[model samples]
Target: MEEVSTKPSGYKEYVAGLLAGVATVIVGHPFDTVKVKLQKHSTEVEGIKYRNGLHCTVRILATERVRRLYKGATSSFIGVAFESSLVFGIYSHTKNGPQPQVIIPSAAFGGAIISFVLCPSELVKHACNKAELLQCRMQVQGADLIVTGMFPGGSTALLRESVGNAVFFSLNTDSSDPHNLTDVGIGILTGGLGGVAFWSAVLPLDVAKTVIQTAPDKSCQRNPFQIYRRTGVRGCYAGLGPTIVRAFPANAAAIVTWKLAMKLLGIKNE
Candidate 1:
């Protein structure tokens, strides 16, 4: 039997993680804008209303002279780098075990486990985005306001990935041997399926998070359940379409980047 190495190639993994992070940000950014807008739409400060997703885009373009809807893109770039690094690191480690008898399921287990780090990011990103938006509004109108609020958007993000991975991995099966095109294909498929499952599961929570973050009613005490109840099922999942569309490609990029890194580093066991 080949000796099972505890430590795989760290440098390669790190490089792969970085590359994947950059790619995921680029691929997911547009959809992310749509998702954030949809989620944050109902939020209004006093009588000042931030428009819906389309209007938000138009306003940002027309008023702010920025075609990009997102204000703090640097936050996303850095966050994605960190998040993807952790995710890919964990994934490569878990996937190195004697080819999982049930490959995708094991992969999903790995994916869900990484949610711990990602969840906090979700919370911080939404908070920061809202804060920035509020700042922009106040600055534009020259109003005096101090905005401080915390929402547990990250909690559901972690939950979403955890649950989504569980569902996808449970359904996955693998027949490919090592170092084969078939193996790569299986990996890609596994990642794509896992991404879909993960995003779908979290769609509702994502919607709620957007609403809470952008809403100026910081004094209003409402829970996630309340947000869902207010929005109804459809409202809670308003941005599902865009999310699902982006997830597949983003996940595929991650998987491919990992494989390429592994190969380039000559870290193959075979």
Candidate 2:
């Protein structure tokens, strides 16, 4: 069989990506909140905040209510929506162009764009997640809990996105040929694997970001190296379980939605 063009018009891909992003945030925000909490938990603290993902989910629900799990939802929704749009839009544009072997490069470029948005958005999301906890622990009433700093971990984010998208788009491209299964099924499987790869590659950086973002004060200036030294290898992967669990369904849905939206818009593989 001849190679099929997975290209879609830029506008179509952007719109599809936005839909995918919304679906991803709605499905994955709670798991993501828990993952951040788990990653940022310090052994130095008097007591552990959560024993595991299950424990974390239970506690957040019981004490903070379901809404707490969605702290910073608006920021994440907006950020991921744009981020996904950029990723898909760029990928579609580049793949359709005359450039040879463009998939990897397109993915890498898309990743770079994603990093810019993810840094600030992630910072806000993490701060929002811990705002109540911080307020309760610090006993500061009506305090402005926004954390601000120069963006760190852009390189790692780039690596994660480039590598993960490479895998995702490559797999997605290969799987687009419909033998018996629907496009959605192929998208789901490939997307889930891509999500797993993305998280696995970036979990360490994520842990570092969590630590820095959730630091008790501006004086708590610890880099990724410091965090590694303090927590060791295991610390870098504190919430791997929840992240992987969250990755499959959320990303699968996002990818499926993206592909389906493209189909609905009459963008066909040729």
User: Taking the candidates one at a time, how many backbone clashes does each contain?
Assistant: 2, 0
Q: Residue by residue across 184-206, what tens digits does model 2's lDDT show?
A: 57777888987888788778877
- Tens-place lDDT per residue, model 1, 135-189, is 6545643433322233234455555665565555443333233357777777778
- Highest-scoring model, TM-score: 2
Clashing pairs in 2: none
Worst 10 residues of 2 by lDDT: 141-150
Q: What are the Cα lDDT values of the candidates? A: 0.60, 0.72
TM-score of candidate 2 to 2 decimals = 0.70
Q: TM per model?
A: 0.61, 0.70
What C-alpha RMSD separates each model from the true structure? 7.8, 6.5
Q: Give me the candidate number with maximum lDDT.
A: 2
